[model samples]
Target: MKIVTWNINGIRTFKSGIKKILDSFEADIICVQETKVTRDLLEESTAIVDGYNSYFSFSRGRSGYSGVATYCKDRATPFLAEEGLTGLLITHEEAVGCYGDQLEFSSEELLALDNEGRAVITQHHFTGADAPQTLSVINVYCPRADPDKPERKQYKLQFYKLLQSRAEAILRSGSHVIVLGDVNTSHRPIDHCDPEDVDNFEDNPARKWLDHFLSGALENGDTEDQFGNISQKSASGGKFVDSFRHFHPKRSDAFTCWSTMTGARQTNYGTRIDYIFSNRFLVENVFSGVDIMPEVEGSDHCPVWAQLSCTLLPSPKFPPLCTRHMPEFIGRQLKLSGFFVKVSEKQNILKGYKESLPGSQEAGEIRENMNPVVQGNNIIKKRPADKEAETKAHKAKKSKLTKTETKPQNNLLAFFKPKQTQLNPPSPELNPDPGSESSACLTNAILADDTHCNSTQTKSSDVALDTCVSVVTETKNQDKQDKETAPVEMCRKGPCSSFWKEVLRGPPQPPLCKSHNEPCVLRTVKKAGPNLGRQFFVCARPQGHASNPQARCNFFTWVDKGK
Candidate 1:
């Protein structure tokens, strides 16, 4: 059985179609640290892998920070699993039943340590030589001592102490313990790239604690022999063994983590803070090999793994808590499609429900009259008499529509129709007798209301009649002139009409960014500065790290100033 440990930095790193990356390791069990995922944010794709069963411990105090997960191959599922090293988070069934002594720390301190989701422990049962053995794998992402926060240094030390107590307790319970993850401290001068750069390297509390914990020695000198060489039999002496050093104790520059901001990984300048530490008995007997993989590049910390000589044994008691058991993937829940489509006997059940309700007989009768009835697989049509009656009503409606269309046109129809214009007005049609023509002219002038018809009565009657006739002729000429100019006026207004299509056309294309040759996006300044409320164009891509290829470029220009 092979087990690998890695700090994936954040579980979301697997979201970009790289979830299968875990399978590439080919290890029986894979432990990840700094998952930065809360229980609410968990996803099916992240939790479920093709051939793996996973268990996750999420931060109870925060979201998107400090979580751990373990993925074991289906065949190598653990017999027991629990969260937190303090033993407070475990259920009675899978609990390790040991937490050692906690009298040195207050209750609040113990709660604070586990609330951050720092550890996940899984016990795999295996057979060795004459008897069955249990190996407890403790995956942890230890807290870092922030220089800005002086209190974190003490917290960090306390975390390390709690971790040591838990591992020792598991050992006391007859289970071999394997503690692995980002320890957040380089134990020796050889673990760091620049030993001289760090003042009083051995004086660091975390480093001193780790040394004493591994050797069970109160003093640093007791860990090494008189010749300054580390002993090889420390694993069988009831103490933890650093797996990488157990194989290559003097290996230098074998760093697992680097500073991303300084580009230190390019020069291979880093420290070996990530480790896979196990019991000396396992390293000496059941373990075949152990090493670090610095070539892997998804995170700042690389992967370290250890292999066992024997195959893993499956648990005979309980099933693994894998993604297959999760509610989202269990395939038992109702879906939206179930409501729209008939499945199984649901349609029959619904029909029975309708029939069982009060006043359902009347509703069923109405339905039978309007809709076809289902008899076995065939649909029964409406009664013959009912069909005949329906056909007669349709024919009467069609005949009424035909009669309405064939009727004579009404005078109102002609009133709304457009009238044609004539270039020359036709002479007025009237009787040839002078008296009749005079009367016709007076009638036409009265309808036109020509101001000349309202002239003073002192003038001769013949002269007044001539004035009315002249006024009527001038009105005809005026009407013809207005009709001839109407089309020209309409054409002039057409070009200035406020069309919706024109309004929606919006602004023209913006200038392209120089870096990616992509169109820039317009943005308004929101900060309280000289350019507040001013518009500008910037690269369209989202903001990201400077080294990220998909991150936005530094192309920017004010809207008023063209680039």
Candidate 2:
């Protein structure tokens, strides 16, 4: 099997030269990122040659944002489908699920995931080889939070952490996995080529992109996240091998992607950010003929291809395949921008697992090793004020430390200060001023998982790590009850089939939102179908980023249907 991954930059452009491009590579399967097309256009996106089946995953909120697509030869595709929090993949035609009969997710949680269509996993049944091996092909267009925006940088970090957990789960399920896409981060300095920008990385530049943070391995001379423990490795240890590097050990200049603005491609100054990663077992199956195709044209990124020597046993029976969710995209000329979160979604998911899957070791361990800092991903940060703010905060912190260091040990005021004592532990969010916030709080506020920090203003840096961790631990103890109360079908079918009513607590309609008592308005689904015209109430002030609490609580509601 010969598979390739490329960031097409845009699907429409890629389509114009699709035939010529595919013929040049002769790949059995080609996965493209940033396809720039939404799920609504999935049926119309069948322009690829006659023998291939196309699958896509689209972004939820913004149109023409992050999107991915895969074209697999019919002969190589035994069973293909998409998977995400939607609980099931919804298509214009019908809905089909991956986890068998009962949905493994709650509707509310799945609805929350509808914002980002970054992940799409499809199963391909290969019958031509030895034993029938089920392969899970996951394609992702990871968030590229530019540094100019602090929030987006944080978002990208959170996205990577989430991706790690999801991939780990797939590996645990005993599946052959091949993950491909625009990973966005060049694994090593040599993987990238920009003399001026490259010099800035002479000293370890983990801050540029937490490479070790994403891979779960320790980068030389760095032990913690660039901003402290704002991010950590997947509990699974990120068992992915960069196939390009694995195949060509000495080819430092062999870049798979280049920058358009810098004329980097013209001079061949590029980076191998787009990748084809395989699991430890699958790495042995990849042939040595992996090629980085710089000649292909359509986007700034070129294609990376690898041949696999594994035996693919054909399946006599295939699962019922259906349309996976493909949200939105951004082609050339259109700008792509957004705030990214740094915290791990697994923290919440792990908490849920601990309660629901009682005695699950993975959940317990992840919680125990949880990092207190929350960060986001993106392009190199562009916010100068963030650095200035951090600097002023640091100076104030230094002065406070020096004063405390010289002060009498038993000063009466020491007891008066809440931080010195355990009784009045502070809530990081309560303090909004950056200069006044305690250094300990700053660390915890930025690193603490979502349960405690979400609002940009509320993400504080005053409370100590122990205080924040203790608070999180206590919150975890009560989360089984406080977690979002989603409405589930009495029968895991569709909307309720029977008219039913049960006594409910509190005012019938929600009082103004508990986050911001702001006015809320009704929003409708624009996609096609029965629910396409459905409406729900949401907060008036759109934060654009839902990773925050204001956005989370700002949008919440659903209508029940009866027989």
- Each model's RMSD to truth, in Å? 16.1, 33.5
Tens digit of per-residue lDDT, candidate 1, span 261-379: 44567666789999988877887788888888989887888999889887778865433344566566777977786556444454565565354322233234445644577899998
- In order, the Cα lDDT scores of the candidates are 0.76, 0.58
- Give TM-scores for every candidate, taking all chains together and pairing residue i with residue i: 0.57, 0.48
* Number of backbone clashes in candidate 1: 1
- Which residue pairs does candidate 1 place in steric collision? 235-280
